[model samples]
Target: MPSSPNLYVYHRGEIIPLEKAFLHISDLAVQRGYGIFDFFKIINGIPLFLDDYLARFYESARLMHLPVLLTPDELKKVLYRLMAQNQIPQSGIKMVLTGGYSEDGYTPAAPNLLITQQPITLLTAAQVQQGIQVITYSYIRDLAEAKTINYSTGIRLQPHMRAQGAQDILYHQNGIITECPRSNLFIVTHDNQVITPKKDVLKGITRKNVLEVAHQKYATVEGVVTLTDLAQAKEAFTTSTTKQILPVVQVDDQVIGNGKPGTVTLDLWQDLLSLEKQQALVRV
Candidate 1:
């Protein structure tokens, strides 16, 4: 077990301890889930790809017409202060901006901001090392590209997946691969081509980096991949901020590349880990 991390929360225009921050009774985010958020991982005291995460957060807020009450720099200060308050060196931080209190009606209102940080356990490390099985379900969310607070559908699917001994669940709609419940899926062909679900999926930061790195070694890469295409692949993997590069040993009872993490996946994982270390050192 890991040590408990102190939590700092930013609410309204003030920074408060996580235990002290409170939401108003009429906040629409609590009532209707009208909010957007971004998750970031801090490595060696520096946030990995924070700029990209913030950009996405702003984009989500814009799409929902949520006003940007604070600039990015101001938000950065809050994040660092939260980290300091929490005594967090390496952790995961989530910043949530939600529709604030409103009258007795269903309508938009002023927005509220809250940021929280906690230690990241990365519980899937063992699963990554030994590789894990994956199951795909027909669960697709509207506005698949936006990062929002409503994750009930994805949250609801985890129990059913855990009952089957699967590490995660990938979502598909009409035979088209959308994304995994928490991560993005990838596959490598027998011919060394790397394939992933196209722009339809959440263009994950780790996913983007993996594709960029794999381009140097693989001859062909395609983003618009289907279930049929994935099943035919020689190897498969999932990417996320925490998971980094986790190979998929099976997909819905079918073994992927001898039911083990493949050589290409291992190689890419090593490269990504090295890159992370390098980035952390440079930032420090």
Candidate 2:
């Protein structure tokens, strides 16, 4: 659905119309780009894995030294209220904690909490089946473990990615692959081990769940992965809140395995879907 005028958003302790939610020009988030955000999906009116998301949100705030104004229970109540007010069956919620407006525009002030929702863009089955192509670049995010409002590099490289006919950018440092611009990268070795980066990457919620399920049946390892490893891998995939588990068929000029989604990748994808279904039921 298109963005509606009637949608509601929660700002601090007050729920207001989405259009009415505003931040000052001198806000640290605007002036200095100091902020943190967490995003989760709402399915069938239930926020999925919301508690986990909230825990990460608070952790990010703590790492950034930004004080969270509300406790988890209080945030949950406000989120549910905003969800009810928006009345969307399937949507995505984003909670932002900003370094609030400061008189000097440089010092940290009280944090401003803002929560908003919009209709979620569901992935098409064909997109999953056909998989996606990615190109690699050598870079790493600063404060990699924290979910900060710093996507300048990723945003700046969008046009280059588009020109290369790739859907996403996989970031590596020196030759060791760290992550994609927006998701965690994983590869299945020919020996059947599921490997992902062990450091300097955002531990995505979906990646956490995928690792939990994958370790039950496959040998899962978190360590340094190199481009040579990807070249020798049987299959590769990515995990994220929005992307779920998507197969990575081609990376730059190298075609992964048979250039199609591998059996292990598909199995993990199914497992993630099953987990989501179970979480949805519990939320209901």
Candidate 3:
């Protein structure tokens, strides 16, 4: 269950209750999984890097040829109104663009747009202290650059990950680490340099910010970080809009560097918070 019932959603140019938002049966997004989406977090009642996220959302829609039907300014107005309605200090916002309804065929008519906002729920202090375990899977997300509504690979891994008492699954291909189901993976080398997979992975908003801050202060490398390096690294963590910088104390059955969050991970996590507070767009 969600942490709260106060959800603000926008669909098809109309604001509606979350429960009232529905999709048609013949929608191409439902029938063929033809949809693009983006997710980001809010801070101090303000969305973080919304412009960047929206640009990528538009880019994905262009790649998939889905009609957005709203100008960026119009979309921003709707989004701001939705956020105001929710009235949360911080939240997670998602925008989904789907190929709209069609006849009894694969061809799409227009496109469907949806925006949802939920209160930002953070990991409890206990959870953070105890840390969480992660599992590795062979499933690699398709269209990694474009955040789409379809989640076939992640859906398939959920049951297995839960059965193993894990929170999420990290994906890999050809023995090279790619990313987690919903986060970007990073590792700290023996020399304390942060290493992350290059552009092949999703250019997540939080991931981008974290890397920028890390590079500005600490040594950082963006490249093909192999599974071998990840397993042997001094520390590991995953970054996302929600997770921020969560330490990966364990992978499968192997423990990473005393099976605890490393000093570098803690430093980067603090840096992330400082960066956000510094960059926050003050709200009235």
TM-score per candidate: 0.93, 0.97, 0.93
**What does candidate 2's lDDT look like per residue over 115-174, in tens digits?**
889988878778998998999999999999999999988899999999999999999989
lDDT, candidate 3, 1-284, per-residue tens: 34346575898889988877888889888799888999877888888888889999998888778878999999999988998888877778889988889886499788889898887786654565565788887766677788777678788778888999998788888878888878899999999899899856878888888899899777999998887898899999999877788999999998899898888888888898888887676553
Task: Report the lDDT tens digits of candidate 1 across residue range 1-284.
Answer: 23343555778888765667788878888788888888988887888878889999999899888997989998888787777777767789988888878786357688888887777866455667798788888877667677878788778878888899998888888888878877888888898888888766667888878887887787546467788877888889999988789888888978887887888888888888877777777662
Minimal lDDT window, size 10, model 3:
122-131
Tally clashes: model 2.
Answer: 0
Off by over 4 Å in 3: 1-7
Score residue 283 of candidate 1 by CA lDDT.
63
Candidate 1 deviant stretches above 4 angstroms = 1-6, 123-125, 220-222
TM-score of 3: 0.93
CA lDDT scores, all candidates in order = 0.81, 0.91, 0.84
Ranking by lDDT: 2, 3, 1
Q: Where does candidate 1 clash, by residue pair?
A: none
